[model samples]
Target: MSAAEVTAMPEGRGGRMTRAQIVNAALALGLIGFGLGAWAMDETFLVTLATKVAILAIAGAGLNLVLGFGGLVSFGHAAYFGLGGYASGILAHHALNYTAMFEWPFVFEGTTSMPVIWLTAMAVGALAALVIGALSLRTTGVYFIMITLAFGQMIFYFAISWPAYGGEDGLPIYVRNGFPGLNTLDPVQFFGLVCVVLFAMLGLISMLARSRFGLALQAARQNRQRLMAVGIRPGGVLLVAFVISGAITALAGALYADLNRFVSPSMLSWHLSGELLVFLILGGTGRLFAPLAGAGLYIALEHLLGGVSDHWQFFFGLLLLGVVLFARGGVIGFLAGGKRHG
Candidate 1:
């Protein structure tokens, strides 16, 4: 980033943090504090909840790159998400069973290593996004949305029909994947790992938004003609963003699969794609930390409301409507005092 860009960022007046910075700091630190508190209390479930927020936040952040910045309403992001999950699940399955993934392809074996699984998941997501986005980007508006959704469903059905792993029944990991020197079985340990990754992703995203390519992305979104006049290709920029989005979300899916010790078609379903969008909208579309805020609010509300009422989504839907209508900046924007575009 240029010195001008770095200097232009708001750090607040009189040596104080900006409102958005304060809120962003709280969101990041608060999740760590909450997880630690849960660990102190031996509340494994709550720790898991915090981890879920971090994972979902990662997923939401990825989608935000595409929808919030790239101006692509991808209703099929779950395709990449589930692909990542299955990637993890399948690798773990073969590793545990002492079987080769395929006899062909140089006799490659599965792995229980978290790092390996994450890399593989991200690659798969990126590749899928490349092909799908290439085709889907050919259209605009609702046609693009439908095409993405159609691709997602095709993946979803393929997962169901393929019984080698689990098919419609889903595949089980049996045991959580391994991380270097960490007790993967311990909720707190896993939560710590996931939170670290989430914060790193947020930082990377923040930097990307201020980078040259990031500026081009926004320009494409705001004015394709203007970006084209500047000799920037909107299609290429958007496609890159879409692929990056898929890869990040897929990483989250892999972590999620590890957390749950299972993989299912549900991960690839349109419902999840919609829920991700809801998280983005709820947290604030363009906000740097919107994913965490949105997913945290969503899971919190679901937990609180589900205990009191079975039809909790009805109330949640109403709240979502309110956010869409009034809180365009989402929870972060509402609290931080800024425009989504700003």
Candidate 2:
């Protein structure tokens, strides 16, 4: 190409890039730059904080499925969250203690593999959801909300009373879990794993929202009678969504347990359940990437504000209240203008 022609070309393209492509390219470049910067900094605290944000984002995304899309408005999701955490902790404990988890007709042993832990967490969470959802789904409006809250409290109390795995004292992971060839003890590798999981979950959620099942679920959420008339069982659809939602949250729980290297009754608390919902509201519900963005911003605010003043949470509460009252769509909706479905 001639020098004159090259000079006349747009920076992003050989000629000129469309607005959409330019925006996407900029975002990709920005993320790459941020990752490179974090790698170079090698700051333990920041990296750890970022991992926490990612984990919280995953939890938020799961909760969003129920609250935002399904319109379930569950207040007891922390039960699944804590269940996933404890599952990992208990398994790791048995493995480290050099004891088999079970020896039935078949042998089962504890494992630190990320994949195994994830599956265990999902299974446990799904089972819990099955029971809770079955009962909770029977009631509608305020009754459903109360039942879910009650179930959450029940699990929390059970965790606190259980003498195993430190009870109220909590269980420590000692070392981060392993992922095949990856050295999870390394901050960057751990962070990368978290990022991969977060993105994967995001992708899964997006695809689910586009699927026919998702359409039916949304319809059931809006009008149960109508969906039933259309030959779709509303309860069944909601039940499936609930299970998937719980499973995703449980995956987050496993990551969280590994992140903190601890699992306590506190993980099962109603307060945590509320916080997960809060993260969804703060980010904007229904949008695919809202949870991730919201979690990142929330953590950043917490870190910055906490460092500035001991009364930061008080002010943070005020900020959240403002968003709830004034910002209808959360931070993402505010930035993006209108709410984007799917």
67-155 per-residue lDDT for model 2 (tens digits): 77678889998999999999999888877777888899767778888899999999999999999999899998889888999999999
Best-fitting candidate, measured by lDDT? 1
**Residue 36's lDDT in candidate 1:** 97
**Clashes within 3 Å, all models in order:** 0, 0
The runs of at least 3 residues in candidate 1 whose Cα sits more than 4 Å from the true structure, single-residue gaps closed, are 1-15, 340-342
Total residue pair clashes for candidate 2? 0
Off by over 4 Å in 2: 1-36, 340-342
Model 2 residue 342 CA deviation (Å) reads: 12
Q: Candidates' TM-scores?
A: 0.95, 0.89
Error of 1 at 253 (Å): 0.5
Which residue pairs come into collision in candidate 2?
Answer: none
Q: Model 1 clash tally?
A: 0
Query: Candidate 1, residue 281: CA error in Å?
Result: 0.5
